[model samples]
Target: MYVVTGGEMHQIDRYTMDQLGLSEEILMENAGQAFVRHLLTSVSIDEKVIVLIGAGNNGGDGFVISRLLAEKGFQFEIWVVPPVERVKGTARFHMDIFKRCGYSFIEYEANSIGFRESLNTCSVIIDALLGTGVKGNLRKPYAYVIKAVNESEKRIISVDIPSGVPSSEGEAEVYGVIANETFTFQAPKLSAFVYPSALHFGEVHTLEIGIPKIAFTEVAPQRQLITEKRVRTTLAKRPADAHKGKAGRALIIGGTQEMTGAPVLTTDACLRAGAGLATMAIPACIHPIVTQKLTESTFMKLPDAEGEIRSDVLKEEISYIQYDGIAIGPGMGRNISKPIYEALRSFNGPVVIDADGLYHMSNELHRWCEEPRSGPTIITPHPGEMALLTGRTIKEVEEHRFEYTLDFAKKYQMYVVLKGPFTIVTTPVGEQWVNTTGNASLAKGGSGDVLTGMILALVLQQHSVIDAICNAVHIHGKLADKMIETHDIFSVKASDLIHSLPRVLRSYRY
Candidate 1:
C-alpha cells in the first residue's frame, strides 16, 4: 500500500539486485512475463502489436515482451527509437537476442513515413519509450514518436511509468502518453494517485517484479491507498450482548434558523455509522424545524437571542448532557456573540470543532487548545479554513499539507483533519494517516457535515480518535464510490451519500 516516488523506486530496484543478490535479468523477465500475462488475459492478441522501445531498461522490458509474444506465435512489430545500436547495457543485450532470433526491427529515423504507417496499422501499441526516471520535458524523436503513437487511435499500454510523466507530483507538465492500461512494478507510484498524471494511467496493475519484501519494509512511504481489506481489518466488531448505551451517545451542536439541515445531516450520518444514540442542541427558534427534519434523534432547544444558540444556554446545557462525545460548529454562523464563547469554554468532553466553529477558534486558538475543559479536540478544516487557522494562504497550505498539519496538531495537542484531495488526519501522538478515499462527488454542500457526523459517531462509540477518523474517512469515500457504481458523480447528492451509509456499513463483514 506504500506509494513511492520514481527516484525511490529506482533505488529500491538497485538495492534488491545488489544487496539481495537477485539477478537484474530475472527481474526484467518477471516484469515482462507479468505484463504479457495481463495483456493476454485483459486484452485480445489477435491483432498486430507495435512496441516502441527507448534506450533504457524500460526498452529492455519491451524487447523481452516482444520475444515472449513471438514465441507464442503472436504477430508483432518492434520499433526501436534512435535505432538498436544506440540501446545500451541490458537493453543492448536484449536487442542482440531479438535480432538473432530473426525478429524484424524498424529503425526510427526522425522522419520515416513507414514508422507512421506501421503505427497506424498496428492494433495495439506498447509504450516503453520512457520510465519513471524521466524528468523535465522530453525532446526530439522521443516526443515526436509519442505524439504520433497517441494520434494513432490504437490501444496503448505503458511499461513502468507513462512516457512524459513527472512520476511523483502527478502533474502532466508537458505532453504525456495516454495508455489504456499501465503496468507498474512493485507498488503504485505517487503519480498514479495525483491529478492529470492519474488520468493517463488507466486501469493500473501493480505487478510484483521480484523485489525482496525486506526492501519494501525498509523504505516506508508517507502516502497510502486505502483498500477494502485494510478497512475490514480496522473495523471493530460488536458483541452479541452489547446494549445501546454501551455503544455510546453523541451530542451535536450546530444549525441556525436558515441552515437547519447541517445538524440534521451530521446526526443522521452518526446514526447510520452505528452510534447508539444522537442528540442535537440547536437554537430555540430552529429546534422545531430540526426536530421535524430528524425524527430518530432527540433535540434540545437551547436559549436563542437572535435565532442562534445563546452562549449562556450552552453553559447551562453542558452540565446536564451526559454525552460521551460532542461535535460543534456545522452551520453555526460566524456571530461573535458572548454566549457562544462562554458555551465553548464550558464544554469539557471530546469535541469536534468544524466549519464556522473552526473560523471562530482561529483568533483565540491558543486559549482553546490550552483550556481546562479541552479533552481530545479535533478540528476539521478545508484548505481555506486551515489557512485562516495557520495564518497562511490556501496555496501555501496545499503545497505543504504535511508540514502544516503536523505543526498545527503539535501546537494544539489535538487531532487535525486537513481536508482536500487526499485528506491528512494527523494526531498529537506524532502519527499521521493520509486518507485516500472519497472523490469529487463529495464536493457538494453538506458533505463536510456528513463527515463530522461520521467521525463523532465513531468517537462516541468509544473508538480511538485516530481509528475513528480513519474508519469514517474510508466509509465516506466507499459510500461515494458505491453510489458512483450506479449514478453519475456529478448528479450524486449529499443526501444520497447519507442514505447509502447503512447499506455501505452493512457491506462490511466486521
Candidate 2:
C-alpha cells in the first residue's frame, strides 16, 4: 500500500475531486459516514461522544459525523473549539446544516470551563482539531483544547491522523493528541508506521473517503507498507525438477578465537534460509568449536596467525572453493589479517558484509564496492557501524537514514541495508524497501550475523540482489516477531532466532 505524506494526500484529494469529477460534498459525506460506521463498529453508540472540532474541513467532517449520529438516536455532544463564525467554505455549510437540524453546538472560547467539563463527562472523545495540513508547533485555542482533551480520561478517536502529529516523519513535536484509535482517510500515512508517532497512533484503521484510484496511482508514492500479499506475490516457488546444485551454495567467512558463535549463527541461519549448501571459513583455532556447533554444513579451517584468519590464506581458499555467494564479518576481529584482505579482494561473488567486517572495511568499504569484479554486494550495518563506515555521526545517520542509505547505495553501486527500527534496503538504482516486520527482540548480539547469513543464502539462490535483501530482511524480522510471540523478548537469544527460521519460513508458504 502506498504511504502518502500530507502534501501528497492533499494533491490526491484535489485530483480526485477535480480530475476524476467526484463531488467534494459527496466525498465529505462518504468520509463522515465511513468514520461514523467505524465508530459504531468499534465502540458503543450508547456512550456519550464529545467531538472537539476545529474551524476547517476537518471540523466539517466532525460536523457531518455528529449530525449522522444525532439522527440515529445516538446521544452525542458537539463542541466547536473555534466559533461557528471562524468556520469557512464547506465547513460553514455543514455547521449551518447541523444548526438547522436543531443539534446544539457549543462555541468554546479561551476561558470556557464547560469544554473541559463536557470532555470529562463524555465516554469517548473525537479529536478533529487539526488535519494533515497543520504545520510546525500548534498554538492557541487548538493547542489548549488538545491538551485538555488528552488530560481527560476518555477513549479518544482521531479523524485522519492524530492532531499535532506530523504525518510524514512520525514525530509528535508539540502537544499532539494521543488517540486510542485513529480512523485515517484514503490510506495509511508513513508516520503511522515509523516511530514515536507510531506509538501514539494506537490502533489505526483506514476509511475509504471516495478518493479515485487513478489519483493515487498517478501520484504514486515512493514509500509503501510491506504487506503479506506483496511478499507472497514476490516469492517464487521452486521448480519441480530443481536440483541441489541449482539451489545455490553460500560461504560464510568470519569468527576469531573468542567469537566462535558468530560464524556458527551465520552458517546455521544460512542453512535454515534454504541454501543448498552452507560453509564457514574461520580461524583454525576456532574451527573445532564451530564444527561442533553445526554438523549440517561443511567447514574450512583457514591458516591462523595470532588466532585469527590472516590475508595470506585468502588466495589458497579462493582457489580451492567456488561458491555462489559469501557472507563476511560477524565476530571477525579488527586486527590486520593478510589472508582475510586477500579473500576480500579475490572473491568474485555476491558478498554480504556485516558486523566486524564492516568495521574493518571502514573508509575502504566504498573502495572495495567500486572494484571491477565485486559482484552484487550488500552491507548490513546498524547505526554505529554505518556511522563509522561513512564518517558520519550516528545522530546524522539516524536523522537522515533514507537519504544516507540511498546516497551510499548509489555511490557504491551496491545494495545497502541500514539496519534499525525500520530496516531499510536501498538498491543501486535508488529504490528502497523498508522492512517493517522486526522488533526489539532482535536487539541482541549476533542477530545481525543471522541476517547476513540469510541474505547471503538468498543471493546465492540466484535471486536478484534487491529481492535477496528484501526477502532476507522480511524473513529476519518475521522470525524475531515469531520468537517474541512465543517467549519474552528479554529471554530470547540470537540462537533461538536461528532455530525458529524454518518454522517462520514454513508459515510463509502460500
Candidate 3:
C-alpha cells in the first residue's frame, strides 16, 4: 500500500482529476459515502452524533455525511467552524445541498454552553474539520475544537485523518484530534505509521476515493508499506529433496566473554528462522558457555586474546568456512577489526552486518561503500549506529529516517534495515519499504540480533535479497505483534520473540 506525503497525495489527486477525468465532487462524494459505509458496519451510530465541519474539502466531506445521515433519518447536528459563506467550491456545493435538504448549520462559539454541552452529550464526533492540507500547527479555532473533543471522552471517527494532524511523517504537532478510528482515503497517510503522530490515530482503515492505482506512476523511487500478502508471496518453500546444505547454511561470527548471550540468541534465532545449519564462531574461552545453549549449531572455537577473538588470526579461518550466509556483530565489541572486513571481502554469499559488527563497518565505511565486492551486504542498524554511519545526530536520523536511510543505502550500495517501531527496509537502489508490523513490545535489547539472524536465514534460502530482508523485518516485528495478542505486552523480551517466532512464521508458510 502506498504511504505518501501530502504533496504526493495531491499529485495523485491532480492526476485523477486532470488525466483520469475524475471530478473532485465525485471524489468527495465517494470518500464520504465510503466512510459512512465503513462506519455503519464498524461503529454503532446513534442520535446525538455531531459532525464538526471546517471550511476545506474535509468539511465538504462532512457536509455530504450530514446530508446522507439526514436522508437516512438519523439524528445528527452539523457545526461549521468557518462562516458558511466562506465554504466555497465543491465544499460549498455539498453544504448548499445539505441546507437544501432542510438541514441547518449550528453556529460556532468557542466557549458557549451549547458547544460544550453538544460535545459532552455526543456519543461520537465525526471529525472532518481538517485533512491532509493541514500546515504546521492548527489555528486557534480548530485547535480549541480538537482539544475540546479529545477531552469529551467520545469515540471520534475522523474523516481521512484526525483534524490538525499533518499528512506527512514526523508531524511535530501534538494538538490534533485523538480519533478512536480514522477512515483515511485511498492510501494511509505517512504520519499514521510514524510515532507521536501515529499515537493520535488509534485504529485507521483506508477508504477508497476512486483514485486509480496507475495514477501513482511517479516515484522518485516510491515508498510502500509492507503488507502480509506481500510477505506471503515473497516466501517460498524448499524442495522436498532439500538437505541441510541445500536448505541454507548460516555462520554467526561474533561473541565475547562479556556479551556472551548476544551471539547465542542470534544462533538460536537463525536456527528457528529455518537455517538448515548454523555455526557459531566465538572466542574459544566462551565457546563452552555458548555450546550449552546451542546444540544444533556447529562451533568454530577461535583462540581468545584477553576475552576477545584475534581478528587478524581468524581472518584466514573465516575464509575456509563453507556457508551460504554470514551474520556478524552479535556480541562483538566496539573496536574495529580486520577479520570483520576480511569476512566481507572473503564471503561471496549474503552477509548481514548487525549489532557491534555495525560499529566495525561504521569505522571503515569508505572501503565497504567504495570497493566492489562479490555478494550482497545487509546491515541492520539501530538509530544510534545509523547516526554514526550517516554522520548525523540520532535525532536527525529519527526525524528524517526515510531520507537518511535511502540516501545511505544508495550511497553505500547496500541494504540498510533502519530498525525502529516502523522499520524501514531500503535497497541499494532507491526503493524502500516501511514495515507495518511490530510494536513497543519489541523494544527490548537484543531484538536486533534476533532480526539479524532471521534476515541471514532468509537470504541463505536463495530468495531475492530485498524480499528476504523485508520478510525478516516484518516477521521480527510480527513476533512481538502476535505475542502481545495472548500474553502481556510488557512481559515480552527479545528472547521471547525468538521463542515465539513459530507463532507468526506458521502463518507465512508457502
Candidate 4:
C-alpha cells in the first residue's frame, strides 16, 4: 500500500478532480460518509459523540458526519473552532446540508460556556481541527481547544490525523489531541509512520474516500507500507523435485573464539532459510565451538590470530570455496579487517556484510562503492554502525535515516538495510522500501546475523538481489511477529526467530 506525504496526497487529489472529473463535493461527501461508517462501527453507540469542526475540508468531513449521525438517530452535537460563517466552499455546502437536516451546532471560543460544557459532557470527541496542512506549533484558541480535549480525557477519533501533527515529519505538538483512533483518507500519511507524530495517531484506519484508482496510478507513490500478502508473493516457491545442491549453497565467514555464537546463528539461520548446504569458515580456535554447536553445517578452520579470523584467511580460501553466496561478519573481531575487504573485492557471488564486517569497511566505503564486482553486495547496519561508516553522530544517523540510507546506497553502489522499528532498505539507485512488520522482539543480539544468513540464502537461490534483500528483511521481522503471537515479545531470542522460520514459511507457502 502507498504511504503518501501531504504534498503527494494533494497532487493525487488535484489529479482526481482536474483530470478524472471527480467533483470535490462528491469526494468530501464520500470522506464524511466513510468517517461516519468507521466511527459508528468502531465506537460504542451509547456514548455521546461530539464532532469538532475546522474551516477546511477535514471540517467538511465532520459536517457530513454530523448530518449522518442526525439521520441515523445517533446522539451527536457539532462544534466549530472558527465562526460558522467562515466555513466556505464545499465545507459550507456540507454545513448548509447539516443545518437543513435539523442538527444544531455551536461555535466554540477559548473558555466559552458552551465549549466548556461540550468538553465535559461528551464521551467521544471527533477531532477535525486540521488535516495534513498543519504548520508549526498550535496557536491561540485552537491550541486551547486541543488542550481542553486532551484534558477532558475523552476518547478521541481524529479525522485524517491528529490536529496539531505537521504532515511533513517529526512529533505532534504537546497540545495535540492524543487520539484513540484516527480515520485517514486514501493513503496513510508520513506523520503516521515517523515518531512523536506517529505516537499521536493511535490505531489508524485508512478509509477509501472515492478517489479514483487512476489517481494513485498517476501519482505513483514512492513510499509504501509492507504487507503480508505482498511479502508472501515475493517468496520463491519450493519445487518438490529440488535437491540440496539445487536449493543453494551459502558460506558463512565470521566468529572469534569468544564470539563463536554469531557465526553459529548465521549458519543455522541459513539452513532454516532453505540453503541446501551451509559452510562455516572461522578462526581455527573457534572451529571446535562452531562445530560442536552446529552439526548440520560443515566447518573450515581458517588461520587465527589470537582467536580472530586471520587477515589472510579470505586470500587462502577464495580459490577453494565453491559456494553460491557468502555471509561475512557476525562475530569476526576487528583484527582481520584486510581479508574481509579482500573477500568483498574478490567474491563474485552475492555478499551480505554485517556486524564487525561493516566496521571493517567503515573507512573504505568509497573504495567499495567504486570497485567492480560480479554480484550484488548488501551491507546491513544498525544506527551506530551506520554512524561509524558515514562519519556522522548516532543522533544524526537516526534522525535522517531515510536520507542517509539513500545517499549511502546511491553513492556506494550497494544495498543498505538500516535496521530499526521500521527497517528501511534502499538500493544502489535510490529505490526505497520501509518494512512495517516485526516488533521490539527483534531488538536483540544475533538478529542481524540471522538476517545476513537469510539474505545470503535467498541470493544463492537466484532471487533478484533487491528481492532477496527485501524478502529477507520481511521474513526476518515476520518471524518475530509470529513468535510474539505465541510467546512473550520481550523474551523473544534470535534463536527463537530461527526456530519460528519453519512455521512462518509454512504460512507463506501455497
**Which is the leading candidate under lDDT?**
3
**Candidate 1 lDDT (Cα, 0 to 1):** 0.80
- Among all candidates shown, the one with the greatest TM-score: 3
Residue pairs that clash (backbone atoms under 3 angstroms), model 3: none
Model 2 segments more than 4 A misplaced: 170-174, 312-316, 337-348, 365-374
lDDT of every model, 2 decimals = 0.80, 0.80, 0.84, 0.82
Clash count per candidate = 1, 7, 0, 0
- Cα error, residue 45 of model 4, in Å, equals 2.7
Worst-scoring 10-residue span by lDDT in model 4: 166-175
Which digits, one per residue and each the tens of the lDDT, describe model 4 over residues 1-510?
Answer: 778878889999999999999998999899988988877776666778888899988889889888888788777778888877778998999889888877778777633666867678878899988888777777777888887888888888899988988775533233477898888998888767666567788988999988878898898876676677776787776688999998888888888977989999999999998899988888888776677788998888888888887777677655534777888888988865654565567667788889998888785666776774656788999999999999988777776777788889888788899998788888888877878778998888988888989888877776778877888898899898888888997899999999888888788775
For model 2, residues 1-510, the per-residue Cα lDDT tens digits are 667778889888888878888877777789899999888886776788888889888888989999999998887888888766889988888888888999887778743777787777789999887887778888787778888888997898999988888877624243588989999988877677555667667788888877868898887766666666666656546678887777778888888897889989998988888788877888989977877789998888888877788766666655434787788888888776443344556567788888888877673664565573456778899989988877888777776676687788887777889898878788888876777788898888989988988888877766667776788889889988898888998887888988888788877774
Return the clash pairs for model 2, or none. 310-339, 311-337, 311-338, 311-339, 311-340, 312-338, 312-339
Steric clash count of candidate 3: 0
TM per candidate comes to 0.88, 0.91, 0.95, 0.94
| lDDT (tens digit, per residue) of candidate 1 on 43-139 | 5658898888899999999999999889888878888887666789888788788879988677787437788888878888999888888887788
Candidate 4 residue 262 Cα shift, in angstroms, is 1.1
> Candidate 1: which pairs clash?
311-339
Report how far off residue 73 is in candidate 2 (Å).
2.6
Q: What order do candidates take by TM-score, descending?
A: 3, 4, 2, 1
The alpha-carbon lDDT assigned to residue 2 of candidate 3 equals: 83
Residues 1-510 of candidate 3 have per-residue lDDT tens digits of 888887788888888899889999999999989988887885554656799998989999999998887777777888988767778999998888888888987868533457878887778789999888888767767777888899999888899888888777654445698889999998888888776788888898988877887887743327888889999998857888999989798889888898899998999999988899999989889988998887989998887787877767556656544788888889987553745665567668888899888888777777876684568888899999999998898877877788888899888888989999789988888888999888888778788889988999888887999988889998888898888988798888888998888767987883
